[model samples]
Target: MSIEAIGAIGAVEAVEPAALGVPAAPVAAPGFADWIAREVGQVDATLATSENDLRRLATGQVQNLHEVMIHMEEAKLSFQLLAQVRNRLLDAYQEVMRMQV
Candidate 1:
């Protein structure tokens, strides 16, 4: 291809946002139940994986201490994050219930 054609291709590829002609919508925040469910699911998956690794380790299927430790840590962090989310949700519910009509 010629240099001029390459330059034109580059120019077309660098189109500005205005040229797209569509406004982005504002993002909506997730509800408390939705957030809790997502966090719970993540923690559940992590826990399941850790359990599987532990089983494998017991059966002499895999022998990597570092890998087991990493999986354990991941499960721990996920559980901690889920617990915090649950506490926040409970606090919000209590605050709403205490509101005077």
Candidate 2:
């Protein structure tokens, strides 16, 4: 028997960068910017897919209600995690900005 507490953990790992005009990651030894960009791009992709699924469901194109709900919840958790990351980063940046030289 298997139980899924939060599906977002896996979903967060499933995004690939399509809009960046560059390879997804590690093809050229990814840097910090590359890593962050890839993460954001992937989360964005997940959110986009979730949104599309919602639209399809509303239009009766989706047959599995449970699957759609799972996807939506994953997207929600992913977004919340992303938001927390952003907040922490911003806080760190502000702290750095306030530091004395």
Candidate 3:
């Protein structure tokens, strides 16, 4: 390809707001509390599903024991992870509270 053709091919096409002196759009980032709330909410949903499975098994309406066990394990793991995250956050908060500042 000719130099001019190559130059055209290499030309910038991506949006460049600063190049045209236009301000970029604002983007909202999730706060730490929001992130923690989402994690807890997900774990709560898993636990609720596990509870339903337990209820079904108690009522002799369970389809598969294996599936219930899997759900129980999944719920257990999610709860454990969420609990650990919460504990760590608490510890961090306590540490910050102890700070001189």
Instruction: For residues 1-101, write the lDDT of model 2, one tens digit per residue.
Output: 34564665676654557665666565566687888888888889889989999999999999998988998898889889889988999999999999999
Ranking by lDDT: 3, 1, 2
Which pairs of residues clash in candidate 3, taking residues 3 or more apart in a chain or in different chains? none
- Find the number of clashing residue pairs for candidate 3: 0
Cα TM-score of candidate 3: 0.72
Q: Which candidate is the best by TM-score?
A: 3
lDDT of 1 at 49: 96
Name the weakest run of 10 consecutive residues (lDDT summed) in model 2: 1-10
* Model 1 TM-score, 2 decimals: 0.64
Clashes per model (N, Cα, C within 3 A) = 0, 0, 0
Candidate scoring better on lDDT of 2 and 3: 3
lDDT of 1 by residue, 1-101 (tens): 68898778767666665579866565788896787787788889999999999999999898797898899999999898778877997899999999999
lDDT value, candidate 2, whole model? 0.85
lDDT of 3 by residue, 1-101 (tens): 58898889769688799789998888889998898888888999999999999999999999799999999999999999888988998999999999996
